[model samples]
Target: MRFGIPLLFGCVVAGSVMAVSCKRGEHVWTAPDTVNIPHNTSGELIRYGRELIVHTAMYLGPEGKVATISNGMNCQNCHLEAGTKFMGNNFAATAANYPRYRERSGSIESLDKRINDCLIRSLNGSPLDRNSHEMQAMIAYIEWVGMTVNNGAKPPGSGIRELPYLLRAADTSKGRLVFDNKCRECHGTDGTGKYDSLTKEYVYPPLWGPHSYNNGAGIFRLSKFAGYVKANMPLNNARLTDEEAWDVAAFVNSQPRTEKLFEKDWPDLNTKPPDVATAPFADTFSAVQHKYGPFGVIVKSRKKH
Candidate 1:
């Protein structure tokens, strides 16, 4: 499953820039050309890093050649286009913004710490040794991807978009309908996703069940899931409305998945995001309210304090 080149979907080359079409009226961002990677040992590491991201499951999954760890899902499954796509959870600013405080850990985290967070939470896998070649390659690729971004600045479309909260709690029934109609073709009716045996990876990653992201993964949050869906779901034909996105997210997340308990997360309860989907809240909102929100009230209450 290793590839010499990184995956670049729906991109058009103009001069030296790669323009990827985005949501209507959104500014297009340029991804650095892989062609520019130097033909040296450093470039080899960078290329290996891209392969690690694009084929993470092959190298580091349950039956991985490197290690038997992650839940058989590639990092690109969520990061999208090896973390290059705009508003598609791209890594456009990650390199420049590390050693920053994250309320989740309540401490300043290095880039490797953040990568391990994704390994532990998103991939539901054990952390790669920070000193390992795999870890260094991943760091090299991510840093090279974001080298042009100014330090401490998140460029436009660096992460998931934020959709306004629905006036009502997101409806699973409605979400099921949206999933069946839009998502089932690739992800399957059971939401098990389509596995490509030849490639030894999922063509479409599962939305839920034992193999999907754990409860603590960022996409487990309805807002993040909905926003990600709105921007880049249903594969090539992303056209879900905000309401549809929110509902489908609720539907997908409601199904069973692995759970991760992190006692240290949100040490300051007040700093927790509104859609954590777990308990021990600083507010009086029910777990249901936190998970499937008519979250305007919860949000408003948080703002006043």
Candidate 2:
């Protein structure tokens, strides 16, 4: 399948081909546009889902009508551009391969489970009732966006791509400079993010603070955060070197933010990522070492096992 640039009506004329690969193998497919939604119940549900994702805070924040389970951040904060843009934590493949096994929980999890995990961790709040209309609507939108994908397949560029680990732990001092130069303009020097007064939501969400993602959010993980920075930070243009990405991540994460929960996370110790914020891991490394760097050793050890 070939994808063209989407028009206002959701139709594409011609553009570059975006290749996607599933767990089975590489294939090409076009992402559907919200403009193409039919006038029907299913379309309404799908549209509702998109609204929930893009404006989650309005519906799920502390003052939300649907539920109060997020830190006033839209799902688009990390999922980026409504989960459509590639390498920006997009949801292009999420609906296709969920209800699959995840190392974090050490069980076969459903879409609702995955959504709740973000709610609890990234959103830094409680979980939505799995049967709730909000949850169902969000799922509907993800499924609609990914409906073209085959089940059990993980398309290439499905999620945030990883940047190579640094030779040593990231240097916060250097990272501070990088942040000042590249990120501080939008995220603010203090990392408190710029807000849209009219919407009462952040245009550039806080990177670290009470309102930011707690320590348990996936963004708290060094590699995940670094990769995301390398691929999508500064919006529109992403030109950070791998080292800059890592250093900036270290600098940002080293700052103060909300406390994290989840004592039972990564039930299978061996499956834990090297940069998990807390300790008591399958390895004999210290919590500080785990949270910081020289993660190549951890990666090598995991491979050996």
Candidate 3:
């Protein structure tokens, strides 16, 4: 499955591979270019997969052409540039690593299952049919995106960066101020987001309310949301300090959104991350603390045990 592209050397930081380019000097990881894809059937599938990733709502949203399923938000709404942006929940390492065990689901998951997980949780929708062209195209695109990377390598910016845990619970009131000042222009004052009637999708995704990611979605975890917001937010003017990011994430997650029941998740409680917003934790931390932390203690307790 090699793409025959030369590997760029990069340094490791916090256990992930950072990019090495002549200009940046090992700072940024770049996704492979789409133009390099072959002019073949598989390439066609890969291209279609990218389309699915970019315009998932057009094909799969409530008013979708392919199937009426997902909430109006597109996959790119969370994935950012169809999962090519660094530290923006991109899929740069996904294809290379998956069919791997996930602590959240507590099992070895195929890429297909992973996509469906997003459909169910993040998109607040039902799973796409596995055999459908849309599904196959998405798989091809995601695999092709990561084909150049080594197997089992998590490139430095593959996913959301883990910000240092705050010493206190994230303050929703303070977060509200941050959102009103920095986030409201794009996402709207009510947090319902800007709607595109022509495209029938969100131009800027809702931070909360019924259409946003459900409780079971990864970003519902304050850490994940904060990291994502700090890396990319306010439509390119992302200057939120770490504290501001953490607070705003708390504020957003506190708002009403969709809910999902993950009765089978986290079968191994010990492997669960501290920010999981649910009950029956491996430790005795209150659910509120688990949701909005002061997580340094929880993390330390886990390491000690």
Model 3 stretches with alpha carbons more than 4 Å out = 1-28
TM-score of 3: 0.91
| Model 3 score (lDDT) | 0.85
lDDT of 3 by residue, 1-305 (tens): 21222334654433554332222332345677877889999999999899888888899998899998898898999999989876778998998898899988778999999999999999889998889999999999998877766889776677887788999999999999999999999999999999999988899998888888999998899999998888887666678899999999999999998777798999999988898869889999999999999999999999998
What is the C-alpha RMSD, rounded to one decimal, of candidate 1? 5.5
Candidate number that wins on TM-score, 1 or 2: 1
Poorest 10 consecutive residues of model 1 by lDDT?
A: 1-10
- CA RMSD (A), model 3: 4.2
What is the per-residue lDDT of model 2 for residues 111-180, given as tens digits with 9 covering 90 to 100?
9999988887787888989998888989999998888778876555568776777889888999999999
- Compared with the true structure, model 2 gives a TM-score of 0.90
TM-score of each: 0.91, 0.90, 0.91
Q: Which residue pairs collide in model 3, if any? A: none
lDDT by residue (122-224, candidate 1, tens digit) is: 8888999999999999999999888877799775567888889999999999999999999999899999999888778887898888778999899999999
Per-residue lDDT value at 260 in model 2: 60
